[model samples]
Target: MPENPVLDPKRIPRHVAIIMDGNGRWAKQRNLPRIMGHKVGTESVKDVVKTARELNLEVLTLYAFSTENWKRPAIEVKGLMTLLKTYLKAEVQNMVENDISLRCIGEIEKLQTDVQKIVTRVIRETAPKREMKPSLTLNLALSYGSRSEIVRAARIMAEKCVSGQFDPEDYSEQLFASHLYTGGLPDPDLLIRTGGEARLSNFLLWQLSYAELYITETMWPDFKGESFIDAIRDYQSRERRFGQTSEQLQAE
Candidate 1:
């Protein structure tokens, strides 16, 4: 059972996405190096993953690094990559033990060779097998940009059409989504952004078309299981009518 009294277990979101923000701000507030905040943020990630497993969440997508993040100082980018590598290496065994499958969505080729190797290894090791059905799928969005993803999918569809493998008239929302990086995954049910940011930050623009948004002032380093539960609780309070009227939803 969930620890939160207000959270309805039956109403839990199947897929939840988060944009972890404020690492630099958090470090600056503490007069520490920005990398320090990122380092501590890894601990929060562990906590949230544990919580997600406890809640039986089907999928958790984390916005780890964006394509635009490459514009930051070289040192910071290096530090972030190192942190990512360390996190994956350290968490692989834990994820396997916990039956959490690891997945990545983005331009993975853009990552360093060593980081790519580790990512590939982790994904291979944590993949769900016939006898080992994963309890959760943890997706890390690295070097990801929604616009670029959209364009990539479009290019693939166009090429298929030109090759006579696909018809131009076959383009539909469902068919287009099949070409996306998140083709096999459901769209996020909720999107949680830390650091009080309300914008999407070029993350999952299409997948988050109808996801409930939860913005928090808490920094990524400070967001833990309790904070996550609070977001879930808030989500359960809302009535997601999609495009239907409240009366129509009630009638159904």
Candidate 2:
């Protein structure tokens, strides 16, 4: 870690989201199997977790897998699922020990029964961790889309309205947010997509309205601690005034 290796806590983003991309490309560039890229990417996860905790980031959501990813070859999917199972099984104890609570948001029921079992077990076991909050959305965009989430929320609200749950006047941004999968979690303040991508790819569509975007060329396997820190540092240097002009922001 760099000495005083931190951005100002006051200005730090309360929540950070990342789209980890380019694992397969990285593997290919090195003449290795694609699974090898994913394996190496796992190493980057440890570094990012530690850094996020140190930075006092309240929430960190990672786009681990997408609904669209299922379109890939069956063997690749199995490999990814296997890696997920092994990683979750191996990380449960570490997550609890680190006080990093494990949370998931997605149509996890679609996962194989065995994988679901391990996931449920890990969540329960790490439920007591408080060191840091992590909400990992695996198999996201699979049966999960921002539009779908928003529509679901609206439907819930409509049902409530019909049932006389409350006045429709109560349906503000805050109220609508309550119906979201990330309802209790703070909205991501910063969103980064590695591998030089700038698109959202359907991750956290509603939560990143005002987020600062960071795009990097580093592949997921190569995106280690230092790379993450560099992005944060870059973020710290930015001027986020929401919608205000510089003069108005300065006056505030």
Candidate 3:
């Protein structure tokens, strides 16, 4: 895909997170099964991942499934797991070839046993080597929820303090953040949500505190590379002062 000529290469976001939405709606409008929407959405995933790598993004986090998704119909849930397994099996080799490391952030153990095995294998296979640093890290949020993540981190901190391994008085935002699933990764600089959604939907609440958000009406399946570049172009046009006035930012 041709790069967007308007993008300032230096201003590209290092980390980009996406909430892939409207899959079911897309399929419904086409008179197809919801799973078909998910299936087609994988192509968009591929396109976005390729675009991010070409742009030299450090991390690309995708909200694949949420903890609440377990409440969905059993058949749909099962199909999603099967699709996830299939995607991992088919994409692991490509990921390795492209120097993209796969990482999952969520209650991975909650997935089906077979799906878990494949996920583990993909992560292991795509692990970055000392000599071959990964061009991008593809982080999938499977069976994930931000509130639960924050609670889990809090519990870990409490346990550490009880064991005398941590001092409560020394606690800081950094200390608390280190216990979260995304401990070592940089926070997303840009978050894009498809399907006209205006809500966060319990995704990366803490990490997205200061991130620029881009919402699109296009469904996930149709969000190709050009759509992604459009988001980047819009992002570049904004002023992210991070709580400072224009004068203050310009002075820096």
Task: Give the best candidate by lDDT.
Answer: 1
Clashing pairs in 2: 67-141, 67-142
Q: Which one wins by TM-score: 1 or 2?
A: 1
**Candidate 2: 10-residue stretch with minimal lDDT:** 135-144
- Best-first order by lDDT: 1, 3, 2
lDDT for model 2: 0.79
What lDDT score goes with residue 131 in model 3?
Answer: 51
User: Candidate 1, TM-score vs. the true structure?
Assistant: 0.97
- lDDT per residue for candidate 1 within 201-234, as digits (tens), equals 9999999999999999999999999999999999
C-alpha lDDT values of all predictions: 0.95, 0.79, 0.94
lDDT of 2 by residue, 51-133 (tens): 77777677788888777777888888888888888888887777766667777776677778898898788878877535443
Could you tell me how far off, in angstroms, the CA of residue 202 lies in candidate 3 after the best superposition?
0.7
**Each model's TM-score?**
0.97, 0.91, 0.97
In order of listing, the candidates' clash counts read: 0, 2, 0
